[model samples]
Target: MGMTTDPFSLLGLEPTAALDPAVVRQVFQERAAAVHPDHGADAADRAERTALFASLNEAQRCLSSTPQRLRVLLQVRYPELAASHAGAVMDGAFMELFGAVGAALEKAKAVQSRRAGVVSALARAMLMADETMAADAVMGALGAVNDAMGALERALPALDETMRSGEACGPQLKAAAARAGFLEKWQAQLRAAHAGAVG
Candidate 1:
C-alpha cells in the first residue's frame, strides 16, 4: 500500500522499472491460483490463500497502468507529488502543460456533468425540485469538482516547492489533497454514469 514498497514485490515479483504487463498478469494468476477461495477446501491454506488472492488482485490492478499506478503510488508514497505538482509556480513550459491538462479535465467534467445532470434530474425531480433546477444542481456540483481540481492543480508548484525545500507542513498540499478527494468522488460518479450509458 505504501509507495516505498514496490507493488510487484507484494506479488513476489521484482519491482522493475520497466513494465511487462504480461508478466505481471502471469504472476497475479499464479498467486491467485494458490490462494483463491476455490482452494479453500484445505482449512490450513484457506485464509492464507484468500489473503494472497486479495493482495494479488490489488497489486495487479494497481500496477496495470501508469496513471492508476502513479496515482496509487503518489497517494500512498509521494502524496506530496500531488500538491507540489498542483500548486507550484514554475517556468512557462511546465505551467502551460499543467494548465492545458487542467483545462481538459475541466472541460470533460463539464460535459459529463451536463449530460449526467439531465438524466439525474429527470429521475430525481419528484424530490420537489423541477427537472431544470435539478439538472442545474447536478451541473453545479460538477463545476465545483472542476474548481477543486483546478485549485488542486494550482497547488502543485507550491506543493513541489514545499516538499523539495523540506517544508513539512504545507497548506497547499493539504488543500490539494482535499481537492483530490473530491475529484475522486466526482470521477467515480462520472464513471458510473458512463457505465450505465454503455449498459
Candidate 2:
C-alpha cells in the first residue's frame, strides 16, 4: 500500500487503536470484495485491481491485531514517534524480567531441538521427562510475560484517552508500541514452548 493511505483509511474506518474486530472484519470483507480483480474489472485494469485488493488485505491484517494496529496508528498520527522510540530501552525491572524470559526460552528451544532429533521411543520419553522437569521454569517465564502484557494493556486506556483529548501523545504511543513489541516477542517464545510440549 502507498504511504499516502494509512490502514484505517484503507479499511474505511476512523483512525483509532481501539477498533472493534467485528467492524474491521466486516469492512475488510466488503472492501476485499469490491477491489477483487475477479469481480468483472476490465482486463487492462487487473494491475490496479490487484494492487487495491492486496492493499485492502494488508490493511485488514494490520488493523486486526492490537499491536500492529497501534503501530500503524502511531505511524499515521505521529510520524516521528517510531523514529524516536524505535530503540527505547526497557526499564531495569522490565529488563530483568525480559532476561529471565529469554533464558527460559533458550532452554525450551534446546529441549525442542533435542526432542526433534531423537527418533527412539526411549529417547523421546526421556526428553519428555526433561521437559516435564523444566515445566516450572517455563511456566514462570510465561507468567512474567503475561504480567508484562497486563501492564501494557493497562496503559492503553490512558493512551487512548490522551489521543481522544487531542493531546500530545507521541511519547505515550511510542512507549506503548515498544512494550507491545516486547510482549509479542515474549509471547511467541512462550508459544514455542507450548507447541513443543503439545507436539
Residue-wise C-alpha lDDT for candidate 2, range 138-171, written one tens digit per residue: 7888888888877777667777788889898877
Off by over 4 Å in 2: 1-3, 113-124, 197-199
TM-scores of the candidates in the order shown: 0.43, 0.82
Whole-model lDDT values for every prediction: 0.54, 0.78
lDDT of 1 by residue, 1-199 (tens): 6334457567776432234578879888877776787768787678777766777787897776533543553554455665465543344643454454454445444544545655565454443233334344445555555665565555455555555566564444344444455466665564443343222
Candidate 1 segments whose C-alpha is farther than 4 A from its true place: 2-6, 67-91, 106-199
> Which one is best on lDDT?
2
